[model samples]
Target chain A: MYEGVVQDLIDELGRLPGIGPKSAQRIAFHLLAADSTDVRRLAAVLVEVKDKVRFCRTCGNVAEGEQCRICSDTRRDLSKICVVEEPKDVVAIEKTREFRGRYHVLGGAISPIEGIGPDDLRVRELMTRLADGEVTELILATDPNLEGEATATYLARLVKPMGLRVTRLASGLPVGGDLEYADEVTLGRAFEGRRLLDV
Target chain B: MSLYRDEGVVLRTQKLGEADRIITLLTRANGRVRAVAKGVRRTKSKFGARLEPFTHADLQIYAGRSLDVVQQVETIASHGDAIAGDYGRYTAGTAMLETAERLTAEEKEPAVQQFLLLVGGLRTLAEGSHPPGLVLDSFLLRSLAVGGYAASFDDCARCGRVGPHPFFSVPAGGVVCASCRSAGAVTPAPETLGLLAALLTGDWAVADASDARHRREASGLTSAYLQWHLERGLRSLRLVERT
Candidate 1:
């Protein structure tokens, strides 16, 4: 523990995810040594973000208003909704510029060890969105990991009776990754999902 | 500081910084150890994908003051991919990992039996040889046994009386005879007790031939017993979709 406010600052910073005690202390000292204007700017942005941003009512994506930009965009296909685990994943998919459709952010995956279950996520909201039968295709863009796959499987089973064409993202080796260095499971998946090359 | 090599299972991981991760591993010889794997969050990380949960890896670690650093890691079994593809297996595997972590509460203590049980459970789960739920239950029972909390299915837990016990009591260690039966003791079907015994003893043929209803009953009893012994319920066990 340090003197008064310095310890308080470290404790506060440490509460943030991924910021451990050592890093929190280091950051607090760095902030104290740096210009007050920079620290104030960062503080202001943090408050501003919490005050202005909210989850989109329809899709659960982070938004400034009732709906996110993707949810509000009429040009995007409403008949398709690419479901992702987080808003950050939405940005990653959007950067590809390939998916011209709406999105449903599940907030987080079903991590039982973390005590996050189907009920904790935005699953009910997603089910409500699909109840209208407007979405013709539901693309599961969840990360290809344990929790992500669990969430996808749960959602897939839930929406199977709804007659929606559900699909999942193809997972394989990275573009520049070497085949010899690839793990057997990933290599096997790459082979299983091999595509025909077009010249 | 010295460097050492060990084969271990990746029990869990937490993000340490922008591009680093702190991994908790249950090693075959070293027991539970937490190590910082620098740059594992980066896209180009050499062994990042191999260090995921349920993965068995051969790791070279650099001993540090507060935490050991993972210098090199090579994949031994990538069970994560197989487990993740199926919901039943995924939940079961998650529960197994959690149990392994919980059983080996002390760090750097050799827990070869617990380690072997986890590896075997993960392998069986990945192979789809048995119902994922059964494998998970078996793992839990065996891990508890190795952790010195073995529950008795046959005979009495408290009085050690002979003959098949009729009542199961969580607080009394396991199945209790009428003479030793305490409050809140449950009378599971004879088949549920048989199923639990089969799972604990690795009698897969009997376990596989068991009915679904018995399996469900056995699962409930097993979970209750586990919670009672551990003094807390496993979060992952609640999410397991029994097959």
Candidate 2:
């Protein structure tokens, strides 16, 4: 059996996805042998993330103060809200550099088995934001899964009644995949939501 | 010893250190199961292809303290290929996988109803007979029912008073009367409740007759009901295309 603190590290690491007992032990040892300064910095950031960053009051995205950077940016289009499930998704969308609109992060998607309901998320906050009538088009950017679709549909129903246009992300099979490799369900969605190529 | 056989659908698979694979399955008799399928990464392995996601199979696994070892596998239905061929079903199936994993976390918990329902749902999806969205909604409603969170459409979800209830409360459970309705729950159209009941009971004749608006409304109800019970949101549900 492993020692107390080392075994504790292994136990904690094992709880993470894709990490098994062996990997957890390996990682624990590696971390134990790592430089003190490097380990201290990693530990410091973990604490800072919770202490410094907080959910935005207006849109629910992660923020340093009252509002997130995207929400406070005057250049961003406030009238169009791109709704998403997690704050991490805000980073993903910003990476594309395509959208310059405000965001509404739902914090989590609707998952019933875990007992996660619409009330558990910041959905009521979204309705409160829409009440101001500044948002016109609400882009649903949740994951391409059942829970995500459920959240998007729930959001659409809530927003459409308020007269905002709700649109979901178009479906397409991932790139670099062979036609033969593509599942018919995914291929069918690509056909149904087909786009006109500029080229 | 005799083969300890059980029915399951492969939830996911990942390559292990080298030639092995870690397969996650939601079994009928056993809840969620993880087993090592040795040398499955190699092309010559006999049952390697049997562990693909969405494929329903009967497995005989060697019980181990550290990790169960897959002894043999027999394909019950090769749904993965057919389901993967369509976009809507694929995305919907992914959500089903997450739901299945959440519903049955403990090993050998006798999730027979859930396993059977998923099998039927995947079979229906692969055949491309009913609308993919409707099929998924039915699966979601039934899955919740199997988990003991069945939503009432006709009777009051709170008082058991029978009548045409107008309000759908995810937190309050299901359909609610004017007396039982919370201050802020969204009231879906009457036709939406009918579609939901039909979907829950597998009365496709009623569900198939639903118009686009009714179907959409019913879907919203089902998804919300599901999320209310499943604490962590499904990672795949965001991809569902609304009609």
Candidate 3:
């Protein structure tokens, strides 16, 4: 209706999460005005994302091959599995360097408002992985959001019934703020999840 | 018959008299709704657990004068039990619930994006896949984006100039320049800004790759931005641990 392939690009880009109609048009026009080589490069990258990036066979993380690096690695502790929502969360945990365990990505969290249920994620795969009896504990690392919490609870119930230990990451007050600055909820969490000092 | 069956997550429930309660829910098809659960507080009630907060239910609610009355209910996911047992998951879940409640204001607000975000967020949380803090941040960033208050990171929040500036002024929208720091603004570190950008955009590669300090810094910015937009601060966010 508007132009050639430019119209299609705008429509597709507009479908992205943050890109709006205005941004879509701007990006489409930019692509049209850019060098053909760069445009082709962008297209290649997009194609590669689908072709090259796939879920890890064992853990469900985005990987270039059959298994994600963490799942395939020999050094990490397979007995300790850190359960997280997406492949991206693996990166977050890796950055901490405090954990040396393998991971299981759930792909997404649960929110009934959006019609997402426990059955929608890679949860069944997790149950399958746990059946081997190699893993001793499951550290639920889903985000501290409602969906993440719901996901953790759902998993704990399912996993615990199988006689596996399920744990959640602790919540508390942040570092850069005084007690005066913290909200009632954070304060409550900090008080509830208080860590014991070994003094 | 008004087609009574619908699926919804109980966002919040307020005690009403002794045996009844008011429930706020976000439905799969009808969007946000407020309803009453009669005698839900009684010990012998059939579906009390199904109507509790954080519980997903397939419900039939008869229309009432002020609110709909829950007639029959089936538990879709009894998440509250597992969540309530763990302090961390419980707090994080509460924060998400409150945030969802705040975002889905205005009955039938046609917030398809928000509805999806909450559902997806809750699922991730329930599965115990990521750290609750990370999940909360993801939800907050996405929620803000859905609410039209998305924070800018690589670009100026006001001017559209692409940058890696670290200044964050929630009232000014997002990241700012040295020159654009609004009055009473805090200049977040460049790393913090980058982390925030990743969170805002769901670039978990960037976010998960960030250092703990940077994630915490970004989280502070996120909370401030969320509080600014929500006006009265998210009652549950305080319970979430940033680290």
Q: i-RMS values of the candidates, in order?
A: 2.2, 9.4, 15.9
Q: Which stretches of candidate 1 lie over 4 Å from their true place?
A: A1-44, A177-180
RMSD of 2: 10.4
Superior by lDDT: candidate 1 or candidate 2 = 1
Model 2 lDDT per residue over A1-199, tens place: 6989888889999998768899998998889999999989988998999899998998888899998888888999987889888888999889999999889898887654344667789888888888888888889998654456656766776676787788888766666656654544456668988878998
TM-score for candidate 1, please give it: 0.92
Interface Cα RMSD of candidate 3: 15.9
Over A1-199, each residue of candidate 1 has an lDDT whose tens digit, in order, gives 7999999999999999878999999999999999999999999999999999999999888999998999889899989999999899999999999999999998889988887788899999999999998899999999775677778888998999999999999867888877777766566777989999999
For all candidates, what are the clash counts?
Answer: 0, 41, 41
Ranking by lDDT: 1, 2, 3
Predicted structure 3: lDDT: 0.77
Give model 1's docking category.
medium
**Residue-level lDDT for A18 in candidate 1:** 76
Instruction: Judging by lDDT against the true structure, name the best candidate.
Output: 1
RMSD of each: 2.5, 10.4, 27.4
Every model's TM-score: 0.92, 0.57, 0.54
Q: How would you order the candidates by TM-score, starting with the best?
A: 1, 2, 3
For candidate 3, give the DockQ: 0.01
Q: Predicted candidate 1: what Cα RMSD to the true structure?
A: 2.5
TM-score of candidate 2 versus the correct structure, residues matched by position: 0.57
| Winning candidate number (TM-score) | 1
lDDT by residue (B1-243, candidate 3, tens digit) is 544677888888766766788889888777788898887765345455567777777888787767888888777776765565555666677778888888877886666777778777777777777767777888988898888888777777877777777677789888777777788778777777777777777777777777888778777878888898989876566546354
